[model samples]
Target: MAGEKRDFNTAAATWDQKTHRVRMANNVAQAILGALRPGPDTDVLELGSGTGLVTLALQPHVGSVTAIDSSPGMLAELEKKIAAQGITNVRTRCVDLEKDDLPGPFDLAASSMTFHHIRDTDRLIGRIFGILKPGGKIAIADLDSDEGRFHESNEGVFHFGFDRYLMRKSFEAAGFVSVRNRTAAIVTKPGPDGGVRTFTLFLMTGEKPARETEGQ
Candidate 1:
C-alpha cells in the first residue's frame, strides 16, 4: 500500500448505497475465487482483503483464510461481515504488504484490484512465491486499464493497466512458472456524469512447480 492508496474506509461507508458498484465488485470477486478452484483443504492468503468481499466468497471452498489489508477501517467492516455470517475460519490483519513480512507457505495466494497502488509488482510477486509451498498457485485480479482517469485526482501508481505483456514478464521474472493472463468481458457502467463507460479487468495466474520428491 503506497503511491496513492485509495481510502477504502470511505468507500465502505457508502458501498451499500452504490448497488451497481457493490454487486459488480462482488461478482468480480466471486469470479476470481471460482477460477482458482481451490480444494477443501487448501490454505489461502489474501492480500488487500478490503472488507472481506473476496475473503468470504473463498471460505466455502478452502480450509482457512488469512486476510490482510492496510486499513483498519476496511478490516473492521470485514469483521462485521464475518460475525454476521458466523464465519470462524477467516482471520484479518492490517499491515502494509510492501514492507511487512507475512506468515505464509500458503497453498494459494491472491490479491484483487490491489496491484495498481504497488510500486514494485515483481518484488511483491517474488515474495509471494517465496512464502508459498512449492507447487502453490498465485492469482491477481486487477484493472486492465484506468479507463481515462476514473480517479484522476486520486488514482495510485497504476503502472501497466492495459499492458499484459509487461505484466506477464514481471510475473515470470518473479519465478512463477506457467504464468497466464485471462481477459474478461469489459464491464460497462454509468459514470459520475451519467454516461456509460467500459473497463476490462484481468486475472493473472501462475504456479510454483512442486519440489522433486526425494529419491526421484
Candidate 2:
C-alpha cells in the first residue's frame, strides 16, 4: 500500500459501474470456486477485496468471509452490498495487509488482481502462511506481466504482472506445498494506445502443511 496508492476511496463510488470489472470479477470468483470448493465449514480471508465484487459472489458458498482492503471507502461499498443483499456471512475490514497483521486461521486466503499492488510478494505470501490454519489453501488471481498497461496509470502498481513460475517459487519459499497455477481468466481491454489487448489472469493455489503431516 505504497508508491502512489490509488485513491480507492474516491474510486469506490463508481467501482462497480464498469461492466468489464464486474465480468472479470465474476470470472475470478468462478476460478476460486473451482479451485477451492469452499463449503459451509470454510472460513475465508480475502486480501484486497475492493468493493466485494468477488467477495459477495463467494460469500454464499462459504461459511464466513473476512474481506480486507486498504481503503475504507471500498469496504463501505462492500458493506452496502452486504446489507442490501441481507447477507450475514460477510464482513469487511479496512487495513493495509502489507504492513499489518490480520487474525485469521482461515481455511483459505484468496484474492483477485491484487498481487501487483503489493511491493513484496514473498513477504506477503509468508505472512499469509502464518495466519492460515494447518492445511489451509491459498488462491490468487492476478495479471501476467503486461509491462504496466493493466491500468490507466501505474502510479500505485508494484508489479505490472507476475511470472507464474516465480510466483510458485515464492509460495514454496513460504513453506506452502502442493502449489499449482492455472489460467483463471482472460480480460480484454483497451490499452493506452486505444487498441484492444488481452491479459492473462492466473489462479495459483497452495496448501500449508498440516501439523500432523508436514507436506502431506
Candidate 3:
C-alpha cells in the first residue's frame, strides 16, 4: 500500500498529461453527472479523485463534494486546481479507504478508474453502502476485464478489471436496489507487444433502498 501511494505521488506531476486517462475521467464524470443529475442541495463523495479531474467537473453541479485519495501529492495537485478554478464546493482529503473512515452519509457516491486498484470488491461496496444515506446512489466507472496487458505496470492494480455480473451481485448484497450497469466507454490503446488493444469501460449505478414505513 505504501509503495502504491509512493508511485502515485511520484506520478502526480505528470498524471494529467496522459490523454487517455483524461478522456476516461471526462467520460466517467459526464456519465455520473447525467445519472445523478445533482442539484444545489446534493452532497457527493468522490473516491480516488486524483488531480481533481472528475472532482472539478462535479463541484459545479453539486452542493458539496468531498474528494478523497490516498496520495498526498495527488491531493495537492487537486487542491491547486480547485483553488485556480475558484471551486469552493469541493474539499480534498488524503485517506486510505481500507483503513480510514470517510465523512459521508452523502446523497451520492462516485468513483472513476479507481476500483481496479482495490482488491476487496465486496467490502468496498459494503463500505460505500454504509456511508450513503437511504435512497442514495452510487455510480462507479471502471475497465471491464481484459488481458493483463492494458497496464504496462501493475504495481498497484489489484484487478486487471472487473466482471459486471459479479459486480452487480456484490452491489445487491450490499443492500443497493435499482442496480444497473452499462458500457460507458471503450478505449483502444497500444499493447506491449505492438498490438492494438481495446478496453471496455462500464458504469454501474445502484441505489440504496429507502426504508419502508410502518403503515404504508
For model 3, the local distance difference test gives: 0.86
Clash pairs (backbone) in predicted model 1: 144-161
RMSD of each: 3.2, 2.0, 2.5
Which parts of model 1 are misplaced by more than 4 Å? 1-3, 160-162, 212-216
Candidate of highest lDDT: 2
Q: Each model's C-alpha lDDT?
A: 0.77, 0.89, 0.86
The residue-by-residue lDDT of candidate 2 on 71-177, one tens digit each, is 99999999998988899999888879788888688999999988898888899999999999998999999998788777887878989899999999999989899
lDDT of 1 by residue, 52-169 (tens): 7778878888899999998888888888988898898999998788889977889999887678777777888889988999899998877786744444344555564647778788
lDDT minimum window of 10 residues, candidate 3: 1-10
Give the TM-score of each candidate: 0.87, 0.95, 0.93
Question: Which candidate, 1 or 2, has the higher TM-score?
Answer: 2
Segments of candidate 3 deviating more than 4 angstroms:
1-6, 212-216
Separate clash counts for every candidate: 1, 0, 0
lDDT of 2: 0.89
